[model samples]
Target: MKILIVSQFYYPENFVIYKIAETLQKFGHDVHVLTGRPNYGYGYILPEYKKIKEEEINGVRVHRVDLPARKRGRLSIIFNYLGFWYNSRKWVRKTKLKFDVVYSFQLSPVTILSAGNLYKKKHHVKHICHCVDLWPESVLVTNAVRKKSLTYKILYSWSKKLYRACDEILIGSPSYKEYFATTLQIMDKNIVFVPQPSLVENSRKIKTQNLGEGFNILYCGNIGTIQMIEMIPEAMKLVKNSLVKFHIIGMGPMSKKLVNKITELKLEDKVIYHGPLPSPKAAPYFKGANALFVSLKNEGIVGKTIPNKLVMSMAFTKPILAMLEGDGKRILTESKGGIFARQDVKFLARAIEKIAATPTSELKKLGELNQIYYAKHFSLETITRKIEKHLR
Candidate 1:
């Protein structure tokens, strides 16, 4: 298949979308990526990438488009979206390379919006939009996108049109597929549940470790608005006496704020902040921890979205300690590999202690089960093949 993947973010970084494209290439498929220049969580793109034209990396062709540095404000995000859409539209037109299908990863829906028109009219390329998260519903909660405003309503309508135009839609979880297909009136055949692809091999080959006498908990991923890291300080305070240490590894807008709160709660000793390590290096942290932490905000819309970290944690055979409600809770409880609590500090502390007290042998078995379940459902090998079967 000749596939063109349009994502707001990509490789040389640890995004799930990049891995998906890479996996497809591994399967003897021709893959081309259209992505923004690398931007660290601080909202700034590297100067070197600004002028980087089309290039090939590791058998995959990449077309880099110039986008403004990552800025946090609502206007900043709007401009970034518009900027990428304009530049990418120009690049696609100028290149004149024919693609069988254009697959877009949401976060920047404008990619589908911009390219869909051109593909439909000129090339008649099939369009596939992967809904990583239900936007406006997801972004609107954060201050990044204005909610309940004229601009938001217009964008929401625009998003609906993009969804309708696409030949197919992919979402990470069944709950999401149901919500969009049933509630939003999207066609059933057009929607599919293809969970986030795994980026790591089996953890059995990786060196294992037991980090300390106390239970060490690790949370690896973006510490941003949807994650609700603000609840962690109180949760840590409640379990300070346990042999529990919290390690947050990943960068985001709330990293500094989380550090400050750890200090204020006097959990500086209990909580360790190690911002953004390379994805390969992250496996050891997951191995080192006695348990992994996955969470989402309490909002109904956010609950439907699956955090990629949960699947990756399961890949490492690490049991998850999730602080979420709804589908996230069901994913863990039904799997029986982890425990969950709402945002209540006392309840979370209790769940933490429950996992902490379990025998190491039992935890290992739980981890293995988690990994097997994740592999069966969310593995890149399985999901990418499913996607390949569908691509035009």
Candidate 2:
């Protein structure tokens, strides 16, 4: 199949969609990516490719579109979306390429809306809308869109239209699937529960056991508002005098806020912020950690969103300490690799202690179970096969 992926973010940007596109390419599908230049991440852009123009990064063909360089405010974000849409439309019209399927990842609804609309109109192709988060929910949490504003209603209506127009809708969590089906009155056949895959390519490199001296609790990936990263400070306070060391290795909109909180709490000695490490270097942090932490915003709506970090931690066989209590907790409980605290500092402290006191042998077994479960259920190979079956 000739597949065209239109995403707001991609490789060297520390996102999973890049790896997913590449993996699909490996499976004998011709994959083409239409994306904005690497924009929102702590990673540095490639020196040569810094100024955006279409170029092949790997085997997959990529059409790099231009967007507003700065991503600071509402006006800037809107401009960025417009820029991507404008450039992407020009590229698509100029090239006049026909694809078997058009798949787009959503961050700003505008880019996908433009491409999906173009593909539907020009080539009469089937569109697959892969939604990582519901728009208004994400925008509200990020402060990008106000709850009851005109902009919010417009984006919400557009999101619903995009959902309805697509041949299939891929949501990251089953909770999202249910919400779309029941709340939005979308048909069951239109929604597919397709969780994101971890960027763990070399599973063989992941050490099954921890050799580190202390219990290192690692929280990786974005530390944004949706993550509720401030919980880390309180959770650290609960386990301060213990043998556990908290390591946070990521940056986000809340990075400065988290750093300030850590300093305020005098947790600089206990909590080490390593900033953002490359994808390859991040493995050791997970491998050495006795447990990994997963958090979601303390909201009823946020309970349904599953951050991709959890699956990566599971892939490394690291026991998880989930701080949210919805679908995330459900997955953790079903896996039996760890326990959920549901945003309670005391309970999180106790959960860490329980993990700390578990015998190394039993911990090792649980770790293996975690890896086995991830391989069976969440690996790209498994996921793509499911997608293929659905496509058929």
Candidate 3:
């Protein structure tokens, strides 16, 4: 099968769609990615990638479209989205490339999939959309937008059309499937639950750094209100276990705020911030830690959705410490990988101490359970085979 994978972000700048495209190629499909210049990690587009529009990296052919570099402010983010929506969609229409299907890895802003929708209409081929984030509901997650407002209502209607245009809609979790069914009104045989595969391999290693002496709880990813990462400091202050240390990696708007809270409560030694590090650089921290931490703001549909980090964390063979609700909590519960807590500080503090006090042997058992569960449910082979069957 010839497949054109559409995504705003791809290789060079870490995203799971690149791995997905590679897997499809391994399955004997001709996979070509239509993406933008690699510039997501840094605020602006990297100088080297700015001039290169297209190239083949690791056997997969990539076609790059020009997009505004993702700058820091909210207005910059909006421009980045609008830029991709216009440029990628236009590129698809004018390109000579042909394929049996067009698969879009929709991370956010439903408008990105509009490019795939146009190709499907012209070619009469299947358009399979992998919805990493739902539309208006996603917009509502930050709490800045209101459903009653005309702007939100317009976006809601637009989101539905783009989704319905797809021949198949791949939902990240069961809860999202419900949202599409009850809210977007597009629930049918076309919609299926196909969780995204993890990019982390079982054997990649990075240089180990100082992650504290005792049982360290490592949290990696965006540091912001949406992630509820601030809870870490508040929870640590309440934690009586001195052995339970928290190591934070990654940066966001709330980085300073998180530091301030830690200082205010005098948790400087307990909660150590290492700033932002690339995945390869952060690998050692994950290796040195006794357990991994994951969290999400329990707000609306976005809260119920399963985060990719949860599935990715399982591949490391480490116990998980998740503070989330809905599908993520249920999956971790079923895996018996680690402990769970609500967004509250006291509960989270207790949960952290509970894991710290568990015997070494018990912790090892939990990590092994996580590995087993990940292999069974969210492994690359399991998901790839399912995707192959659908591509037909």
Q: Which prediction has the highest TM-score against the true structure?
A: 3
Instruction: Show the lowest summed lDDT stretch of 10 residues, model 2.
Output: 40-49
In the predicted model 3, the residue pairs found to clash are none
Q: Show pairs that collide, candidate 1.
A: 43-70, 214-243, 215-243
| TM-score of candidate 2 against the unseen true structure | 0.90
TM-score of 3: 0.96
> Each model's number of backbone clashes?
3, 0, 0
Residue 297 of model 1, lDDT score: 79
Global lDDT of each model?
A: 0.76, 0.75, 0.87
- Winning model by lDDT: 3
Tens-place lDDT digits, model 3, residues 1-392: 99998999998888878877888898888889988888797888989998998898877899999989888788888889899999988897899888999889898778989899999988889998988888879878766479899989999999998988888988888888888888898866478889987878673454556675899999998887778889899999889888889999999878999989999999889999999998878878887889999998887778887888888789888899999898999899999987888789899999999999989999889999998999999988888788778888
Overall local distance difference test of candidate 1:
0.76
| lDDT, model 2, position 359 | 78
TM-score of each: 0.90, 0.90, 0.96
Which ten-residue region of model 3 has the weakest summed lDDT?
203-212
Residue-level lDDT of model 2, residues 1-392, one tens digit each, is 98898887787676788878887888888889998777664333345557757677668888887776545566776776777778888777877777888887765454465776677668888878777767656677777768789988887777677677778877787777666766566774577788888888556776543535677778888888778777777777877446777889888889999999999989886778989877777787787777788888667455666667888888888677778667777777778887677566677777767777777787777777788889888998888766655544
Better of 2 and 3 by lDDT: 3
